[model samples]
Target chain A: MKDMIMSYSDLSSSIREPWHMLLFILLSSWTLLLCVAPPATWAESDKITIYSYSSETSINNFKLLKMEFDSYLSRFGPYELQPVKKREDFERYTKGRKDCLLLISSWHFGNIGQTYSLKPALVGLRNGKKYQKRILTGRGASANVEDAKTARIASAASDLHTKEALSEIFKGKDVADRADILTVPKDIDALMSVSLGMCQYALTTEGSLEDLKQVNPFLHRSIKVVAEGRKSLLLILAFPESSGKVRENMMKLVKIVQHMPLDPDGRKKIKMFGLDGWQPFDSSDKLTKGD
Target chain B: MKHLKLTWLFCFFLIVSSAFAANRMPKVLLINSDASVSKYGEVQEAFKEDIPHPVVGVNLGDEKWDMPSVENLLYDEYPDITYCIGSKAYHIASKYIGEKDIVFSSVLNWLRLPLTRKTYGVSNELHAEMQIMLFRYIFPDVRKVTMLYSKRYTQELFKNAKDKARNMGVEIAGEAVFKGRNTISAFDRLPADTDAFWLISDPEIISDKKGLSNILKRCEKRNLPFFSYHEAFVKLGAVLILSVDNPTIGRQAAGIAKRVLSGNKPAKNVEPPAGSHIILNMRKVKAYHLKYNENALGSVNSIVE
Candidate 1:
């Protein structure tokens, strides 16, 4: 009986408004449904491909950064910032492509001559002298660095900073001559190689000693940074000439990220990654000579 | 009859979907001292999204473990299991975790935190045991090790350090730097006959305006080897610095999270930091003329004479 009454009330209400009332309810819902999060005009497809120079912090820190940068770069039409793990892979992937950016982490700063724009980001003041923060290795290895004449030292890709850092450490002795200088595919690969017996010596940026230790306590005991470079010049973002459109877009994107509200969650990632702030790559400074 | 059939089908679908959703959600809680040395930020990054459970910084430095308000807030939250990251957090959570079903990974003390055999059957507090064993392995010749801490922080860490040192044939000379303005002076007051000092940086050590440089310089002049938390202290005149990272602690803490949620016992016996990451400055070592293996110097992080 209750059902019968409800059906009659529904019939009378429908009869009062008929098609006009039915159409009004339908259209209102259609508009409400449309108010979901704005459609992503850009996605990973449109994401700008960036060369991430990374190693030990890759699993914990890099993934977070890739996510943060993904969100940051979403303002541009969609694009992917791909991280190549090694120098060999980067060379293979980035060759003939101007859209890719070159990133050499400061941990591998022994390559002082392999330039990443010698700009000072953080200074480690010790005994009235400032040294670049660097991660180190070759502490407990058969390829002993201290007095060994023939030892291979690890750094980032063959950039000016890597070349420069090695020059400073090896000093008068021809480092490239003493060691069998083998370059790994990625920044972490170089560090790992030194840690795991694939290579002997590894040098990197200043702030990353804790990161390498987190990977394995044994690795922590096995390696220690030898020399921290003079940190007067700050490392900068670099790019090739072909990355013209992408570079312009990324720098513009960085400018906006500068103003974006940083959350505690977000800052956790920024600090772990050791990014001082983003700067656009100058035309002359961004490109590196082929390794 | 048709309407009733449709309703049954709808309810069946809801049952299937809801089961998947409920099973997928994770329950996590934090046990950090405070923001000054908090690892909460990284743990959140590791597992983003608030999973129906509470995450609090229990030992905020201002509140002690026994404070009623702090205790109530702790007991009020329904943390299925707890993850204690810092020593201070471990101090407070030890009581709470003891009362409930919990699993903890990254405490310096695995033996003290209630490592029971019923935790998934036969148990071994390996991490805790490993650190002690590593200490023995690293310094086989050591006989006496002097340590210092505040009495108020409780004898938990003090006792553990003592036991670990003693088992390896080391006699401990622990000095309590009690509540007073001049704490370093208290450390200095310890018997001069003590062999070496292991300076674990604590609220007592860090809060002192009386720089440890004095204590460190004294150690250097006496040619005493200093074994400390990090190499920074070794640089400041300690013989060596041995420690690990904060995020690794977070990940290890998460591994405990898995066991607790699965109804396993909380508080597995843990070990101290291992020997693999030891730092010995050859310059400093040579100053002491300690006669360490030449192989050890090759693996040092930083060497300051």
Candidate 2:
């Protein structure tokens, strides 16, 4: 107790001057502000946040994709890649964040891009094709879509999107609700389900069928194309419509994406997302309008 | 005109012969112990994907066939290779198709299965070398790890893991508990220098949920990161998990089956699980203040936040 009283007396005695009191108050307030303020406000202001969600990549592999993307983007500035697993969460994160960029599936962008005022900046290319076709493959030799009614169809598409895509392919049959849909992890799994007699048909992409051909030719030859849907655009990198500083910052980030393929490390990173490279988004691409 | 007609006839014959040859390809009978189980179904689908020839699948879970009936069915189909998924399938198939090539997967402690020169298997558990190497990859500073095991369940596994750890400059110490009730106490008695706790697939050590919870709680109290062999343990506060990838195991089994069908013996009779599904519980990692290599996140199959 005596030591505490002496220490208090010493501190009080040292700050007896009017100038000392003003300096002490200023310093204490500054320290309090530093301790209480949210770190994001100050630390993240200069960091470029990129929110990504893709139905094509598995949830687990998305984490790896984020790591690779962040490593490549770090060369330019403070960049962070955040993986959003659900569509609702992606919408919540990117809806009002004008300063951030969204790397998402074109199907999803078509649904919400207009509502959010997002302008397509770049489109992903795979094997030199900007769009791909989804095919319904089966064992039968029929090109009619009505055969899918009441049939078990295996697909790798997200549950909601599968219904939409099926509605488009079947046109007016309402097969999405009538058909028994089995969800798998990858396109190959869906194709294999048809080959192994687990399902009546498989709703997969043309690229996946090509992959199966290379993997097992006999199984590939047995599968017949039941129907093919219209072309669907690949992944799109977009930014919100904004003005002034935010727009300037987004443009700079867009340039980085535009030149990413030229760099070896950046090319490797983009390849993790199953993309060959990036090209300027075509505003006239009808697929982006809707199904 | 005569030459053209002869060429057309020859072309027609070539097409017909190729179609006939395709029909004569060897068949494989895939006997699943239970197709109702999701993992079993996943394995079946993946196996069917890579196997080049036609596959005929029969679900033992869906059928009730007697010995004579099974024998009759085999005689009817007469598969060149028999691929069994679980222990039950392997047992029944081996009993009927004696001395033929059999490839099995998803069998626990596959060392117990009857083996022959023609038997090939994909072990259900990942190899000790792989687990330890992953541990080192994630936590380079963690030099010493401790695990509790029962003599009957994990004696050999512990010794093999310890040897593999030694080769990688990591020390793995094993504590034995004869009863499931003593699992927590055994964990409590772990050496103070233990950097981490590894939970292997030991029946006695992980027999009850309460015992497992107590061990994990003790680990938390001591600030020891828990490494487990199942994804379910992540919710129970496991910092890292290494589990077998069922689909990959199926593909691996298919590869072996293809090789054996082509008249080539596999380089090894029993191969360790090739693929591992790694799960990292970021919440537990942060709560425990564990140090892990950020670069290693690429290899993680799942993350629990």
Candidate 3:
């Protein structure tokens, strides 16, 4: 009985087939190759997702912007220009996601940073300027702040900055009651409302007004600025709190922003974002309470 | 043989007389309100290109000359035609240059100016229908537009805008703000549904800074966009403007001069300037948050940021 068991064990031995030796050698060679491979190629699969809030931005425009940014960052390697356009898409993409990047308005940055504690990577700079002022424009006579109590006002809906500024301007008065306020989703609508006499006045930013002038030259002569409001940074970029490879990549991207591309193609890409170049975001550049 | 000799002498005589006739070219007098205003140079250059006859230019407001002296000069020169530019020059030349063909230009509100059979003018104001058409082109979504005008200055324009606006499916609501009446409050009472404020270049309505400020404030309170006749008003927050192009107007005047020189009966009524330009302020577009119509924006002459 012992001799029969020994013969069976030998028949089933691992070296019974030559193919088993070849499989062992292949496995060892693969393990060795993985161990010796460069870190960059190893980390090629890791991706950083970018998201922009859909306020006035359209999906196609966002996609174009993504392409521009992706092309600019191609030299950096291992980065994807995956831009999330909608608010829901952003939430869904950002939920429990690691190594993510966010492009947010200064207003949203302040609001979201309180909970997530985001670290800014770089902020957009326009014509070498960083701050903008909110203002009230109306017909020449009734556009002033003093007349706002009884005036019909146009404002952007869901815009916290404009709301806050209006609150401060009409602090003592019952703004909700005294002023007949109409809220629209975009700044251009509010301005058109004022221009068309649908409303008496509008609240907007100086930079926004300048941008509007580029599209509607008639508004330059038609809208009279009645009052000025608080100043603030327009846009900012942030990285998630847990810093790792993303932070390193973000640092490199920030360096690129600091020294903007001089080529015409790079310039055209940057101009779409209303910026001539990028600037480092320091403590001084951080948003203040009123700003 | 004697008859042949007589015929040759007569032929020589006819040749010499024809040469003498060629030397006596018609004279044209060019009178400008302010010749130093560089735009007049453009007018002069354009006029010369079209009118080949000899021209004598007179600066109406020159310190070296007065209306009486200018009158004396006109009588002395007895020019075949007089070209008057600007309101001052037009008025002076009309009074001083007697009966000679007069072609007037660079004059604002030429419609109100006195017209004679011998005097034809190119007015700064375009036809009301043209302005209304442009407004419709720029703001297709707008249904109603409001204008504040003094009857003395803008009665015809107001009528024309109203008639044309109706045909174009747009409505024009105008308030007649008479001279010396406190017109500031008139802006406050603008139609609530007004899609835009049309500002006419009436001195009675727009000359007062305080009144203009009040009107602008009211527009702000109501969110009504402003439109105007002057490009300068764009800086004051007007969204759109249509103004006469001086050089183009000058060329048109020269064309009229050619017609008059060819013995065509000079028109007894003032005609709108042949050319004008549209200025758009896109900043106001952002301030009001209007939807950008790329197709409409493409038609504008100049866009201001």
Candidate 4:
């Protein structure tokens, strides 16, 4: 409706005098129909509630995803997109809800899935593969996990996934107990802390470091990946146990998303989320092993 | 009834087709920070030729280029994007442009400038890593270099330089100077075994007229290799200067402008300057009895007699 209002000037400028009255009548009818009339085909459909665990500050990104879903799944039925900022908010939003879908991180999936009984539906793919966490250092520098012992390390250990990856690399030792950890905001900051000599080592993911290098060639020439950690699923679509009809609708939603036609706008929206497309969850074995 | 229905369908199709009519091309506004600077002209020329859209040029330093005039032009022209040539122009454009995409160049101390995701630029100076690499190329045998810089001007570069110098097997004995302090002793305390003296491009360190001559005399007496950031300093006996390729910077700005115009967000929100040339002083090479690397000599852009 907002898009229609914005295009009114273009519509008025291009329509000729002989057709102006007819164009006005058609536009008026269209607007009136949209405002007052609801399509009966969609009126009785259940709302497929999609939720994401992104913070309020990152609500705009989730809004873009919501917009994409609204455009693609209008045929499915009515849907509501909600971005839950806090863990407590998400917990509250998911309490006893069976028809809701979730976009959850791997860390949350492994750590909190048992209590929620969240069944994985689909996963986001970056070039048809999963991403892995990596430890980086200066080129030609030592590439040992033990090297982090005496050296200053840059990582956001506050993040559960980073802490888990550190535990994996350091033989189940807590990150806080091992080395000097500088908790910066983003992966780029951690990588740059190593590149700038503020720290001797940095811990980030493979895809993130690749993105940083692509942006800055100097970082590419100077920084090198020293250690690679376990592969982590980036984004997962999941749902709680629901009735057969609701669960079927959820599956249909997943299939629709997985097979979404990549029109230019659709492609742009997915690219905004740093994903190529959606795929079926193939990390069940890894998820079990991690558990 | 059939003819009336057909006419109604025709009117609806015409309205729908009108919505898809060709959109107005976004105009480009070129802003020059300083009228005296030659790089602005090169950027304007390159931008005019390279950008595939309507363009208008304005210099902030001009008498008629005040805020009101700029605001009026913005209202009249409605540029979708602005290409700012230098720091002053960038500051003005950034203040008034208001959410329009901007690609800026010829900016010194780009790190200090406030920028946005929509704002992108080509920095005026070479990356500190590259600068340190060039230093190693010219004086491979010199392991430790003395440096004088201000935290205000080059703190980030100094931090990057420490990492780069370590990788290149060089060490920097950095003396941090600032306003309202005794900075002379910092220069006097240069280690006896220091192999070279690097004069960073910060006015705070060399703004004192007497202090500049004193430092130069001391370097001459010590017979230390003096590296500088300005080519004019080479004529005054510094070894060489790392000069940014001004014309190349213009072209790089054009490339960024083109990308933004083509609806691609800048890959990097901030970019270090791309091209640099070594300006050498042949007399200083002879006076200091320095042996140059063959490859380094081959890469020199000009030699001052």
For residue A246, give model 1's deviation from the true position in Å.
38
lDDT for A226 in candidate 3 is: 74
Docking class of 1: incorrect
In model 4, the Cα lDDT at residue A204 comes to 68
True contacts kept of each: 0.00, 0.04, 0.00, 0.00
TM-score between model 4 and native? 0.49
TM-scores for chain A over all candidates: 0.49, 0.80, 0.68, 0.70
> Which has the higher lDDT value, candidate number 1 or candidate number 2?
2
DockQ score of candidate 1? 0.01
- The TM-score of predicted model 2 comes to 0.53
Q: Ten residues in a row with the worst lDDT in model 3 chain A?
A: A54-63
Model 1 residue runs over 4 Å out of place are A1-291, B1-18, B21-136, B181-189, B263-277, B294-305
Q: Which ranges in model 4 have alpha carbons more than 4 Å from their true place? A: A1-291, B1-23, B61-67, B111-114
Candidate 2 chain A, poorest ten consecutive residues by summed lDDT? A37-46
lDDT of each: 0.48, 0.77, 0.67, 0.67
Q: Write the per-residue lDDT of candidate 3 for residues A39-104, one digit (tens) a residue.
A: 445265455556666332221245456766687766555554565545566766765555767767
Candidate 3 regions exceeding 4 Å error are A1-291, B1-24, B66-69, B111-114, B180-182, B266-268, B296-299
Q: Write the per-residue lDDT of candidate 4 for residues A130-186, one digit (tens) a residue.
A: 554455454444545677754556663333445556667676665536444444434
- Candidate 1, B1-305: lDDT as tens digits: 99999999999999999998677545445665553544444443332222234445454455564467656866777565665544456566566545654434334434445443322111112222233333333454556666677765534667876765554456777777755355667667766775667676556654554556666777767667877765566546666655543333343344345444655433433322111234555576666666443222223323343
Candidate 1: residue A107 lDDT (0-100):
42
Q: Report the C-alpha displacement of residue B47, candidate 1, in angstroms.
A: 7.2
Considering only chain B, report the TM-score of model 1.
0.58
C-alpha lDDT of candidate 4 relative to the true structure: 0.67
